[model samples]
Target: MQSLDLRRSGAGHAILVRGGRMARLVLSAALLAPLGACGIPYGTGSRVTLSEAPPSAQSTPSEGIMQALTCMRDSHTLNRIRFGIAVHSDGTGKSSYGYEGATGSFLPQGTAAIWASEAVIRAGGLSMNYYELNTERALRQFGGSSLDTALATQQQTRVPNFIISTAFTALDFIGGPSMDIRAGGIGPYYNVRGASLEVSAEMYRPGDRMTMAISSLNRQVFYRDAGIGGGRLFGKGKGELVTGTIGFTDQQRLQEATRDVIALAVADVLASMPVVPDDCRQMVENLKAAHKARVNEDRPQEKPAHGSRARRDDLPAQSPAPRIPAEQGPASGTIANPDKARRNQR
Candidate 1:
């Protein structure tokens, strides 16, 4: 009787061991099912194809307005004015958005500088080439681009009509406004969170770096906080194992938001100019009508409302931009009537 009981006990222990392995396998399959819809399975070594995104071609919000005015007119009104992009990075190290195992800050200062320059260039305006110095020097050494370099150097050493610079000023994560929800230990939960990013830019007279106009933009960026999040777990074993979590929420569109901010800032700068073209000024007004405060906000110390036509009274009295003879305007983007443009404070 004792021998029979021992054999039965051994058989029961084997069955329990087998059952545990089956339970783990089932759990794993349930977890990995989601990944099948996302992409290749882990360690598959397969080429993964991404869903195509809408084609933007790095186009800015003001791109259409620029194309219309420049194509129809003799020249862009701002083309005669030399613009410079300068770097004064103060807030690159601070990151408002946080993700464990994530590398680098979400807000990059370099992109802002590049976007500002491109916005002017795409508008058929003049931009000072501060970058590619190495290539410029090499070309000059080979006598390939000497004439071009000499002309640019002359204009570059003088004060640019305006210099653009920006910095990320604030990043806020609001626990008061952020929402976090949970359901059954294994059931999916809905989560919503709130965040905001603020950036400010200033225009300077290049030679002395004197501040001309100041404007700021604030954007709301929300992210769903992650993790199983120290929540209670419902399980079967006296000794249970734990791992990761599955969530359902819309991913925050940070890249798209950043692009929009950059576009709006560029438009605001043009709108802040003492002599904005009628067409460009109209566009700025339309933007302000559509989206308030995203463009730029006025401060007590600055000239007119951030996105409105510049206040000529606010402009400091100074000699007008030097007039090159009509036959020879700036080396690039020749002005059809230099005198009129200068009168408008080019």
Candidate 2:
């Protein structure tokens, strides 16, 4: 093999570098380096950080969404009914965070309010945006020129069939900043951090704002911060070595958790209402039946255990084709089992 050529313009000289201790150390480190997608070992710093895949905005339906959607689908009158949602207070009352106050806590008041409005709209229910005053002003201005009282009758504010109001009930800190070390005191050093968020939603008639159903839901979000590192010390004397550590962090984004709980609470309220149209009754039943069938299909197929035989009763129910007696062949459709026939007669 050709020795490496070293060129030094300042010294105006070139040296033939033979493979020695330094060269061997470089080679070993290169071999131990982490590989990229193309299997090429790449240079890295002392620390590397990787991110977990966040939740998808649109994917498989969540439990809350499924239940709410199912009921909305069955009702079919959701579009005809309007919902007024207002969640304007901090009910949790826990007064602190690293960044802000209670009302401005991790789970803010606006989160519950907006999530409720979105849930109602997404589930095929008509909802009014009562929060923005500018939009209301614009609407009023647009309808103002309908003359005066004459136009008032033609355009008027819509009444909601149901009103949804929510308040944060509780926020509790769950576990810890616990630590663990392994692999000769150099494995993962991790801690568990979680917070439980609870909120309640009240649905009511808009006429008197009379409360109908209140659904309170709680969700606990758990996350962890962990780090691990390992390195090899090879060579009798001193050689080039690289020690690297990596961090795997799962952050607690409360918005998603809050959205989930809000969706479930809204579903509960909608499910309590018996406002489903009579025409939608059959369709709802069919939808439910199809959902059940899908669930069954997704379940894993079961088989008899090893060294075990299935009994006659263990098999699925199936009616065997009955054979006719030669005397009564073709003409008689009666079952051949006399006992079964007698039982049927009785």
The lDDT values for all models are 0.61, 0.62
Return the clash pairs for model 2, or none: none
> Residues 8-90, candidate 1, lDDT per residue (tens digit)?
99999999999999999999999988876676545567666778898877555455445533432344567688777766353
Candidate 2 structure quality by residue, lDDT tens digits, 12-45: 3422234365688888778766443344334564
Q: How does residue 247 of candidate 1 score in lDDT? A: 51
User: Lowest lDDT 10-mer window, candidate 1?
Assistant: 295-304
TM-score of each: 0.54, 0.52
In angstroms, the error of model 1 at 339 is 52
